[model samples]
Target: MCYNATTSATAFTISVLCSIYLIYSGNKTHNNVDIFAGIATFMIGLMQLLEYVLWKNQDCNWINKYASMSIPVVLYLQIIVFHIANKYLYNATSPTYDNVYIIMNILFAIYVICLLVWLSDQKLCSKPSANSCRLVWAPFEKLLNYKYGSYNVGWVLLLLGFLFYIQFGIPLNGLFYLQRSFSVHKHNYPIRNIFPYITIIAALVYTIVTDGKRMSDTFGSMWCFLCVSYGIVSIMHI
Candidate 1:
């Protein structure tokens, strides 16, 4: 296993708790964003638990399948969280609804469709092997001990998501517009930007560092530590 079962299990438990709270809060406030965040958190928690179980069973092939499937979900959810947070923070109501957001949703859906098609083409999802899905990005390809991997398109999606996030927070005129618009909203801009970025960065760093080295256990331990810390902060926020 790339990570410890106990650590993953603990993180999973924390995630489940955080998700429950988010769902309750979302329902109470009628906030769709909070509900999405709750769902994302639950998915991540479930993935971690599933990974733990597969690891316990010594099923590397299934681990590969799970990671391949889950990473995109995580990345997409990160985008959603950031975009929603950006909308709330800036209060930038576009003249008509947010066409950009709609476009992004459509694009993301298309991208997922393409990804599934690619997965089918490679037969990675149907096949069973430890490294069959290994067609990833430049560094991640190396990190996962494969020359290539199945998530080449995922890297593109993640980049697009991040770009959209920055754009949402600071539109074409950029941070200057953001500052000017804040005057109208009057709500203190809580550092809501930090969470999604931190989560993405931590997940990326953990993936790269843990998989790129022979002594992955050491890095995996730190990854678990970071996940725990993030979970604690998330609960406090909820």
Candidate 2:
């Protein structure tokens, strides 16, 4: 008998759709973290959808238990972490270039490390329990090398994107209608012609080189989607 979890399905569908719509609209407009951040958001939603639907249909209790209980929560938390990271980069008004981004990323790394330790220490929740599904993080991180080296490099690029958006994009495009008296053309933005493009391309190329084929394929797809969408849209509006 097929499980009748329409509520879960509906929730996932709504989230994914909202994410897609936001990305599309945000891309066509200008640099919006709503679009950049939507990648992780939609991935979380997709995982949730798979947990509910795939788990039930496959008749795999373990898969359901693991995915529904642990995976979605972990994915959700990661998405939130990235969201905060992006926001921090966006609102950065500091004069020191790269310092703020480096500091922001350092804090983020510390947070993730602490979170992993706390979760694994078994004080927060029982391992493999309904709420104890965060165990996937430890081994996964090790195997995927999602820390220090490659991951650190990736964080730097993301930080660049956020800072670029805040300083250049917000001023030129006017997100919250903070219009300036000094008129400047859309294409006149400093990083518009170079930094963003180079940053994204370099990130994907590095990931492909260092992280092997799997990560290359994975983040490469995301890189292509984001960079291409932003390029096309930004160019069109220019």
Candidate 3:
């Protein structure tokens, strides 16, 4: 997802280091949440490594196809795992919240299915910047242009769906924390308590700004980088 292989590799290395730290700290403090977060971070790093391979290959070969496919699948698995860990940590047993969670997962499943279908017809091509390659489907771009006047709409919608899919858990977790905070008589808001909301807000702002200013082709790569980097940094607050 990075602009180049070096950037992707660097991100992977940083993620690995952060993952190790999180796991070690979790074990020392006996916090299973941190341990789960560490696993998620490691998965993000693995995705970055796959991205690095894609960047290096930049071809229509099986290696590029599988690497590109793995990124989304890994991301989907990581988010599901993280959601389960968070629910377990919070003991989220409310029927209403559980129903909402199920609905969100169903929507995310649909998005992933569409995304995989879209990717199946895409081919790797160099970006206008020539600094990196991206997956492009000429027919999709033409269809968007014909229907909407702008080719960016499809990418924007896809990105929005992805954002909603990954971030839906944040508010659910936040609601639980807010209720617990009110009942616990806590005077100060700890970083751990507000980190999820902060992450959601930050992600929204970053994606909006980047998409507005950059080419549509960069949206997926840039967002993947941001999410993984945020995942690494957010471990400290856990």
lDDT for model 3, please: 0.58
Worst 10 residues of 3 by lDDT: 135-144
lDDT tens digits, residue span 80-190, model 2 = 444343444245233453465455555545544554453343322112212222122222323233356445444454344345433423222223211221122232333
In model 1, where is the ten-residue run with the lowest total lDDT?
Answer: 133-142
lDDT string, candidate 1, 123-232, tens digits: 22212123422122212222233224555454455456446544542211124334444455433223432454554455557667767443233323433444444444
How does each model score on lDDT?
Answer: 0.48, 0.40, 0.58
Q: Which pairs clash inside model 3?
A: none
Q: Give the TM-score of candidate 1.
A: 0.51
Error of 2 at 103 (Å): 9.8
Q: Against the true structure, candidate 2 has what lDDT?
A: 0.40
TM-scores across all candidates?
0.51, 0.33, 0.67
Q: After superposition, which runs of candidate 2 have C-alpha atoms over 4 Å from their true positions?
A: 1-4, 31-33, 36-47, 50-60, 76-238
- Which model, 1 or 3, shows the larger TM-score? 3
Number of clashes in every candidate structure? Answer: 6, 0, 0
**Top-down lDDT ranking:** 3, 1, 2
Between prediction 2 and prediction 3, the one with superior TM-score is 3
